[model samples]
Target chain A: MREIILSFPKQFKIGFKAAKGIKVLGNFKKLLICGMGGSALPGEVLKIWLKEKEIKLPVEIHRNYSLPFNVDKKTLTIIISYSGNTEETLSAFKKARREKLKLVAITSGGNLLKICKRSKVPLVVVPKSYPPRLALGFLFSSLMKVLTNSKIIRGISREILSLESKIKLKKLEKEGKNLAKKLKQKILLIYAPEKICVLAKIWKINFNETSKVPSFYNCFPELNHNEIVGFESFGKNFHTILFIDKSQNPKILKREILTAKILKEKAVESSFVFLKGKGVLPKIFSNVILGNWVSYYLALEHKKDPLEEKLIAEFKKKMKV
Target chain B: MREIILSFPKQFKIGFKAAKGIKVLGNFKKLLICGMGGSALPGEVLKIWLKEKEIKLPVEIHRNYSLPFNVDKKTLTIIISYSGNTEETLSAFKKARREKLKLVAITSGGNLLKICKRSKVPLVVVPKSYPPRLALGFLFSSLMKVLTNSKIIRGISREILSLESKIKLKKLEKEGKNLAKKLKQKILLIYAPEKICVLAKIWKINFNETSKVPSFYNCFPELNHNEIVGFESFGKNFHTILFIDKSQNPKILKREILTAKILKEKAVESSFVFLKGKGVLPKIFSNVILGNWVSYYLALEHKKDPLEEKLIAEFKKKMKV
Candidate 1:
């Protein structure tokens, strides 16, 4: 688990190179990226990036079976399934093909890859064997490359190159270990600025799957409207973690600080984890790395195997997935 | 709260009538519904309705300030703020105007209404004074009428008319009251089918604000991918509510049943709250009404004032919103 976390940044370059020749032909009006679990994470990251760059294309992530109701001929649907076998993604891929929409598929090796090859659909196959959650670099970069090659978005070569250098793992590992100590036996409530709320969700998912603990997440401004009231009645057993980005809107930044203060007033333990780095990629990837380490260390603190998702495996077997 | 819940269905007819003379002139390619808190619930419900009817126009709900990156002149932006003063929705409305997108506004009475009236934006003003969360019938039906008026979607007048008759408030209130008794002193984990997961989120919000308790929600299939593991290590003090819609994909129905069985195996107390009626409007509103009763009754059980969001009120004052 530690090795995978340490080498995570290296996947970006490999992923970018893997999709060099793959592109879907379309004057796409919108994008529908379909995936489930970890594969869906990239679609979300792309959305934040698109918004940050002020890209005009609307991007929607479909995490269920088939396509969204709004999908049309001008939609470029990208199917991402790390294992290429995710039932939902496969269903979406089949539907996209049936609809005769331009399609792209990203996977390591599964039925998705084979079907895409057989159907002559464009695809990028990443390195196999890593858990989908830990394969973000590969899935995200590959998806971005496909978008770039398709002329849907400008190239992000500089951002992709800086990831490995921008992310400092040793320091984050130490900080994560310390944070994990405080989080021991406590439920987690993660909050992030609305623009990058997906990171908060990713962190919660890590805590659940890695630490085998219950964690919940919501974005700021939105959470301020209703979720903050949840603290009015109870707080002792829950720890609030705020992802503070210096680059966010000042009003939003103020909301985060005030929300933390109110939670403190309600006797809730809270931590403000400031996001580091200058560019959007580093800020995002840095948080992702920190979360990976936090969940990894928290798993060790609980005497659980971070790499083992026994319950998921069992549930999948029962469902015949 | 009881009186409001009992008469909730009646708002549908009143809401539909409120927008009778309003219409935006344009060939809208998409719908951008902007609002926050309870105001955002209507947009989500509309997305589900659009999907059920397979409407091709993409509808995106923006819960934060300004506009999404993809908003353009071809987008019909609907600003819904039950209080009309919601800062986020207000910001979105202003952005929509500045961008010169086709505009429609829905509010009881607030700054949003004033701005729209002064700016000559087509608007719908519903009855005032209900908490935005309980004002769903007004906001939802009114927004639908705006879409129908603009020819964005087919008319839903028949469905709107059936809401009051189809949702049996007496039966749902009784059921909700009984469910609240079982949910007392327990944290809630509400799960719904992925297609209408918005209902799960609305249910969570009701519990958080009305019942003054912590509640979290996620959808099926998606939750099966990661969240199901959280139950492996913890279950006590948690009550899981499953919103079972008989009309969902058979595969999804199977997943929900299997998921509940797994939760029971993990010793988590589970309840299957079947959604009533045939049409989408009734199924959704019935669940909404039931949630209102449960949250209202739960507040009574805890001696908490269901209508008072003291924390939200205090926080907003601190933020000076």
Candidate 2:
């Protein structure tokens, strides 16, 4: 697990190269990225990054089986399944192919890859050793490359190249360890600015999968509207982590501060993890690594295997039968 | 709160009339529904209903400030704010107006009303007595009327008219009370099939605001991929409630049964609430009303004021500063 985390930065380079020759020819007006669980995550990350950069294309992330009803020829559908066998993604892929919609795919070696080859759908096959969650870097960068190659968006090669140097793993790991200690025996709640709220979801998933704990998340401004009230009469073992980005609106910044203060008054505990690093990719991936570390160390604290996801495997097997 | 729930069905009739003469002119390719908290919920409900009916137009629900980056001339932007003053929706309304995009507004009365009138954007003003969350029937039906008037979708007038008769409130309230007693003093986790998962979210928010308890939710197929694993070492007082619809894919139905069995094996408690009612509106609204009663009765059990939201008021006051 430690080695996997250490080697994570290399995924950007490899993922970029893997998609070098793959491209779709279309004047796509929008995007529908379909996947499930960890495979669905890169679309989320990409949506946030694209929003931050003010890309005008609407990117809808779908995690369910079959295609979202709105999908049309103008909508470019990108199917992602790390195992190349995710049932829902394959279902969507089949539907998209039947509709003759412009399509692309990202996977390792599995049914998704095989079908993509049969259909001549553009694809990028990444390494498949790690669990889908741990293989985020590969999935995300490959999807980014697909967008760039298809001329759906401008190239971020320079940003991708610098991502490895920007990540300070040891510092983030130490901080994550400290966070895990504070979060020990505590149900986790995560919040981030709305546009970048996907980071909070990613953190919650890490805590849930790696640490084997029930963690939940929602974005700020919106959470302030409803979820904040849930803490008014807090009588549970809950700890909140706020991912603050200094680049966000000052009003949101103030709301975060006041939200934390109100939670404190209600006897709910919260800690802030400022998103630190230059550029959007650095800021996001740095925090992503930080969360990975927190979950890793917490797994050790709980005497759990960080790499084990027996329940998912079991459910999938049952699903097949 | 109980009275609000009781009169909820009437909102459908009243809301249908609210937009009787209102309409928009455009060749909309998609939809961007901007809102927050309770105000945002109708869009979620509408999306699920639309998907079930196989409406091909894409509806994107936005909860944050300003507009989603993808908003363009071809997108019909519907801004909803029960108070007519929600900050985020107002911001989106302003952006849509500035961009000269086709726009509509739904509200009881607030700055949103003033702005829409000033700009000549089509608007529907429903009765403003209930809290936004409590006014789901009004918000959702009015939005539907707007779509109907614009010819974006066919009228479900018959379905909306029959909704009240479909709800057996006395029977559902008893069930809600029993469920509330079971959920007492436990953190709530909700799951529904992916398309209708918004009901799970609505239920979670109801539990949070009405009962002042922390709650979380996720959809099936996706949760099966990642979140089910979190229960592997469950160490908290978490109670999961599954909202199952018999109309869904048999594969999903099998997954739900298997998921419940596995949760039991892991010693995590779970219960199933089948979504029972004929037609889409009845099925959705019945379960929605059931959740409301559970939260209302749970509030009584906790001795919390279901109608009181002092924290939200305080947050709003502070945000104004």
Query: Candidate 1's residue-wise lDDT over A187-249, tens digit each?
Result: 789999888899899999999888888898999789988888765555776899999888777
lDDT of 2 by residue, B96-144 (tens): 8888889899999989888888878799999987878889998888888
Over A83-130, each residue of candidate 2 has an lDDT whose tens digit, in order, gives 998988899999998999999999998998888788778889999888
TM-score of 2: 0.95
Any runs in candidate 2 off by more than 4 Å, and if so which?
A: A98-100, A115-121, A232-236, B98-101, B114-121, B232-236
User: Which stretches of candidate 1 lie above 4 Å from their native place?
Assistant: A232-234
TM-score of chain B of each: 0.96, 0.96
Clash-forming residue pairs, model 1: none
- Candidate 2's displacement at residue B11, Å, is 0.9
lDDT of 1 by residue, B1-321 (tens): 888888899999999999897899798888888989999999889878877888766778888888887877788888888988887788888888888888889999989888888888899999998989999999998888888888777768888877888988899889999999999888889999888898899999999999988899999789988888766555776789998887788778788888888888877898989888777888888989889999999999989999997788787787775
DockQ of each: 0.66, 0.64
Please, what is the TM-score per model?
Answer: 0.96, 0.95
